[model samples]
Target: MSTTPLVLLHAFPLDSRMWDGLTEPLARRARLITPDQRGLGTATLPDTGAAPSLDDAADDVLAQLDQLGIDRAVVGGCSMGGYLTMAVLRKAPERVSGLVFIDTKAGADTDEARANRLTTAERVMREGHQGWLAENMMSVLVGPTTHAERPEVLARVRELVDAQPPAGIAWALRAMADRPDSTATLRAADVPALVIMGAEDQLTPMAEATAMVDALPNATLATVQGAGHLSPLEDPESVAKTVLDWLP
Candidate 1:
């Protein structure tokens, strides 16, 4: 197996802690680096203006790589993390050895979606992430199967969401809202790619994942059945197994 490092970025409203389950299992095969993006987790986000961009977050990942003396590695992400992965590819293509995109899309947000995200950011800042997120995002974050069968997963998701700082949550929402369409970027990325999607994902469904697979020069799709947008957190073993099988 290749000793290339594996940097797995976390989704919005959560930090590097989300990847806890996969640490022991994936560590056996590769050096896993999971860092909290700027303004999230323990990492402090500098007082950048309201117009935060994923490029900045991408740069943070590259800085982390530099700190570790890793020239290149397979980078993977889920949800908002996928946007950061694409931003990394956009900014520093040579630094990426492979790509793993889980439960995300390659398209930019539509005007309506963008507006909604901005509104959510405002609401999160104003109302805080406590009641608003639990009420609004819980159902949308996970699939019906998890909602019906996995109460523990629901609790964990809630715990992660509640732990996020309001500013960080708001910043991520705005950043994601303004991210560019990554289809062309993916078309140009010549590295091996794995696109994992939840079979029951409400946000980015199978069609979106298929679209990413079609655009990439060399990419494969893995379906995580019975999961939602947060496939890794929903079923760590299945996602890890798919990743292990796909690793170069």
Candidate 2:
């Protein structure tokens, strides 16, 4: 088996700590690098009054890899982190040995979605992540099963969301709003790809996940039952098992 490193990127607004559940198990199998994107967690970057592009975020990952002396690795991400993963594949395909996309879409935001993201960016900047989390945390982050059966998971999600920096949240919103469609990038990638989704992920539903799976030349889809957008948090065991089974 190849001993290439594995880089797992976290979802939006949350930092690398969001992957805590899967970290130990996955780390036993391979070297794992989970860096916080700019302005999130302890990773700080100067805010230039404009949102950084996905390419910029990808560059951050590349720079981190260089600093760690890793030449190539399996790269994967969840949500906004998935966007950065695709951007990395586009910008530096040589650095990627495999790909994993979790609960994310290959398409760019629609006009309405982009507008809403911008509006959200403004709101997060003005009122902070608390207001945004208050409105979206319970309803949008996890699935119905989590809502009905997993109060502990919900609490953990709350903690991760609460720890986010407002500036980082706003920056992520704007970056996602302006991100380009990555369907073409997905189509062109020739490496092994694993697409994992929560069965109840309303944000990126089954149809979207199916589309992503169909687009890739070599890809497999794993749907985690009883989970939602934050599947890693909602059902970390299943996510880790699926990922570990698929990894080389």
Candidate 3:
């Protein structure tokens, strides 16, 4: 980590700890400012009745930078965090120096996918985080290999999911479902960008990753083999190396 700081956003359903493996290495030449998404970290939801939107989530991240006296940083996020990184580009373009998008897409959810997320939200409100995780988490979030080879990873995932506040999850779940498509924004964003895809990612497949890379005017794509949706956990070393190589 350098004396100069950079902001790093955490993926939804997980906290900044997900970046733990890479922090020391990433911080080697740059300071990292990681925030737990609304309801996940020290940040909180707004008192206004405004329902949480993806834009709102991005606003929260930028707001954190303002709070810390940080004007801009190379923004990076995983999955939902990546989605928000795109949002940040749209909402706070001046604050972005670069982007690191991992295991996420720039398109809005399909009808079926949106419906499924809403259903998951309903269940989360009714039964809370565990029920939400039990029903929809494993199949979508964890790669098959990790579930088999690393019990500790799964356990850590469970701990992270289980630790979230019900209310926080409720708002974030809703926020994710309502996020706008950012394909256009990415295509227009002329910043240095890294599109990191998991070779075995089931959620955001290689096709989606390709679409993002193709759209971005200045971007490079790297694949982490033997990893899945949550590549940070399956191959943190690969993810770290990519980030390190990109830093100016």
Candidate 4:
């Protein structure tokens, strides 16, 4: 197997810790780097007064690669991480050797969705807490199978969500709300791609996964059984197996 580094970006309101389960297995195959995006985990939000931009987030990822002396890598992400993956592809396509998109779509948010995200960001900032996200997002984040059989996973997810700083969460919401449609980018991508989705992922279901597969000239879809939007966390074994099989 090739040893090209694999950079796995995390989901929204989550950190690099989300990939903990896949780390060891994947590391045996290739070098793995899971950096916490700005304002999310241990990373501090820059004091810059500028607005949130996925492009800037992408730049941050690329800059990290620069610091590490990695010239190229396979970039992949889940949900919000997927958005950032596309941003990186757009901002610096030459740096990416492959693409892995999990439980995410290539289209921009609908107007209503954008507005809702903006509203939520405002509410979280105003309230100075992210309890609402922790309370409301659990059901949507994991699938019914997880909810019924994996209560521990749900509790772990809640802890991860609750631990995130409100500022980071709010900034991520705004950045995601403004992300552009990446269908064209995928269509033009020259690298191999793997699009994975949870079997029961309601947020970006089979249709979304298939759409990405169809768009990529060289891509395949892997649906994780008994998982949802956060499939990596809900069913890491299956996800890791699929990814390991796909990796070169």
TM-scores for all candidates: the values are: 0.97, 0.96, 0.94, 0.98
Clash tally, candidates in order: 0, 0, 3, 0
Largest lDDT belongs to which candidate?
4
Mark the regions of model 3 whose C-alpha exceeds 4 Å error after superposition: 1-4, 131-135
lDDT of 2 by residue, 1-248 (tens): 44659999999778998899999888888898999998788888675655568788899999999999999989999998899999999999999989999999999999999998889888888878774564475697789999999999877777777788888877888888889999999989899999999999988888888999998889999999999998998988999999999997
lDDT, residue 23, model 3: 82
lDDT of 4 by residue, 60-174 (tens): 9999999999999999999999999999999999999999999999999999999999999998898865567877888789999999999999888888988999999899999
Segments of candidate 1 deviating more than 4 angstroms: none
Give the candidate order by descending TM-score: 4, 1, 2, 3
lDDT of 1 by residue, 165-240 (tens): 8889888999999899999999999999999999989988788999999999999999999999988888999999
Question: Clash number for model 3?
Answer: 3
Candidate 3 colliding pairs:
1-27, 1-28, 2-30
Q: What are the clashing pairs of model 2?
A: none
Q: What lDDT does each candidate get?
A: 0.91, 0.88, 0.81, 0.92
